[model samples]
Target: MTTDLGMPTVASDPHGHLRGTEPFPVAAHRALADTQLRQNLGHATRTIRAKRAAVVGEVDDWEELRRAGECVKADVMARLPELLEQLEASVTARGGVVHWARDAEEANRIVVGLVRETGSDEVVKVKSMATQETGLNEALGAAGIAALETDLAELIVQLSDDKPSHFLVPAIHRNRSEIRDIFLREMPDVDPDLTDEPRRLAMAARAHLRRKFLSARVGISGVNFAVADTGTISVVESEGNGRMCLTLPDTLITVMGVEKVVPTWSDLEVFLQLLPRSSTGERMNPYTSSWSGVTPGDGPQTFHLVLLDNGRSNVLASPDGRQALHCIRCSACLNVCPVYERTGGHAYGSIYPGPIGAVLSPQLTGIDGPDDVNASLPYASSLCGACFDACPVRIDIPHLLVQQRAAAVEAHGRPTAQDLAMRAAAAAMASPGRFSLTERVVKLGRLLSRSGRIRSVPGPGAAAWFGARDMPEPPAETFREWWGRRERS
Candidate 1:
């Protein structure tokens, strides 16, 4: 089916966190000029790619696992409404409250209100993409509440007052030395002797966050997966900070995209296996935490689950585009993506970035028109198909990109110059007489190139191409004529 997913089920923010302000080409141009960013991205992506390749090679049934994950996610999408309802019932039965949010604003409002109910102005947060998507921390801040990020990378991004560049490694664009600089400058408790050494940096961050973790009475997080059969919410991470956030606080708030629910723990198993290898190149995460509702005198006695739709329903409506929801936040596609490796995630302008972001962002917000910033994302790729191969859930990013490109063109509502040119070419090729006339006229282009190269085209549409490079001279004879002569011979 065409990827034109009408409009969002809800009227989402036009320039939501899911969208970037500038177009991809414009952002990418600036990123290309930043030598440090390119270096950081290149080094980090290559290292992760190597690790992922090594570990993935150990799984003989890796492809099978990928297919299984894909099937489970597809089935979940097929029965999403049912599963979400089931999950809500289970959570409520176990004493946890579930809140439904139709958009980012609603989700943020729910979270902010929940924290306010707890009578806490400060909260320690787990690294949550959903919260990031909703600008939850900013929302909390605006409400005079402080949201402190516990994840090491997220902390670095937060301390620096910078946006996350990558989802998994938010500060992947920052090198170690730069990190040391940020920690020294921003971290109130950081040691003056803190070196760029990984251990030292980790210890310094730990020292700084330890007090916050111990004192914070309210915690906020995002779920990696929520099981419908049981009211279990899982959060997997390499660090113990998420565990602290989950357990130390009296009240816990989790905001998750509605698409994150799985029908069964068995379905969760396939993803659990696929996610680790695809993301961190590990057999399993160091910390894979799952909590069901709340337990008396135990971790987070007051639990709240915010189920966020936020344009996800619109993505679900499109058969071609819904596959993006299958992403497990592994960041596998980012590591292997040639475009992402060079430009980094900032260029995509969405909290979600890389190949998946190109398709997902526009689908979430709906492409405004041909000139919409999100519309430029589909063209950010080289269609190399590496993203699909690396994806744990077998999302065909390249196909989705092509589909989104078509949907983008269709969104223009009127034929663009490129559209008109393509239409004329198609019409000409449909008739032998017209084709022959075009072939004769094509020779006229050769006259424009005395140097045997078309330095420029006579239109604005060709400026993007001819501005960068010269085109080869037109052929003296048509391929059809050559074929006829060969057949006669």
Candidate 2:
């Protein structure tokens, strides 16, 4: 009388906290110190940005498409619960088993149980963000199951024991030579003379994975778009690895975030158009796989769909932050994000990185205090608005950043030095006498000026500000004094 996976029935928090161990600034400081990382990120992002721009320029209706994507996502969020139920019914009707997981642990448990039931110790994986978000590979390993990543980039990351740095290209932080080194070091049976050429690297990875694919009995994936109308789940990928995983395995399991659903097949057209150019800068994905359950004598004989909430419902509750759920995983925001271009993904300390991660992570985890790492995520950006411009659904990431910042400040419970300084400034400016006195007192700082610029400041919060920047010297006379002198004249 054992429940799934030989474990007693138990429930865990659906929104189990997922955050980086270190605060963003601390991590970013270490990341910034790596010159090779900066070079790799700069080169890769600039190339992707150019390609995305050229193809996006080809479409006359790109803005309209963005609008449509936004509208459909909004509709999905508004009717999420109903749509999810409909989706579950549709998949079930089509001979698929649907499981609802409130949080990461539940999803992992469900998936592990399914794999164990199949009696397979090994499973092939298509690159899936949902699985990564839940730490599925680690969970599977802990259960004595091996999850083999078939995607070339993912394989590199797996072999290196490294976290993914970019959304589409998980190993974008590594150059060819570095990838070659990892393969030489970690990949078993790799050719002794393997070169860093892209083709050779891909071939080495392909040969390594082909044997696994042929023998793997179970496959796992993440859904890009789930069509509730037809109970169809779709995965859009550039590599054919996804196809191998989806069709070759006897048991196919797909895990998807609740926000990934679209109302109908027609809704996919807009996303199909938006995702490619914004992501890989292609007119269309090289491989698009869709299935609605088990097909007799074709594809997997068994199908399971895990619908994962994991804080998405909580995200939908916030008016300002809910739009984060509209993300299509295209990584357009990441490609255009200046902050991400420098520090790379690992610094953010979450699978979701860059502009979207900055706002989304804090909301997903809930900012509990000033010391929370998720709270540090909001300040990770420069607020230049490039991410919003590149977003397929126009998420207005800067606005979300501000909202999260305010939320963090309110949650801290104790005033920071900057807060105390602001309060002091507010009191000084509240009355004419105090303001005039403060302005005259500040003019005394001209003693610290060199060539009409204050290169350094000695104070608590002001030191970090002046460390890399110089402030313009105050005017010879305060504005109030100038006004008074003019009146006297």
Tens-place lDDT per residue, model 1, 1-489, is: 222222234555633488889999889989999999999999999999999899999999999999999999999888888888899999999989998888898888788898899899999999999989989888899999999999999999999999998878999999999999999999996788889999999999999999999999999999999999899999999999999999999999999889899998998899889998999999899999999999998888999999888778788888778899998989999999999999999999999999999999999888878778988999999999999889989999999999999889878977787778889999999999999999989878888786789998876778776754697789988898899999999
User: Which stretches of model 2 miss by more than 4 angstroms?
Assistant: 1-17, 444-456, 464-470, 475-477, 480-489
Candidate 2 on 151-268: residue-level lDDT in tens?
9889999999999887899999999999999999999999999999999999999999999999999999999999998899999898799999999999999999889999999998
Candidate-wise lDDT, in order: 0.90, 0.90
**What residue pairs are clashing in model 2?**
14-102, 14-103
Clashing pairs in 1: none
What TM-score, over all chains together, does every model reach? 0.91, 0.94
RMSD to true structure for each model, in Å:
3.6, 3.8
Q: Candidate 1: where are CA atoms >4 Å away?
A: 1-15, 424-459, 467-470, 473-489
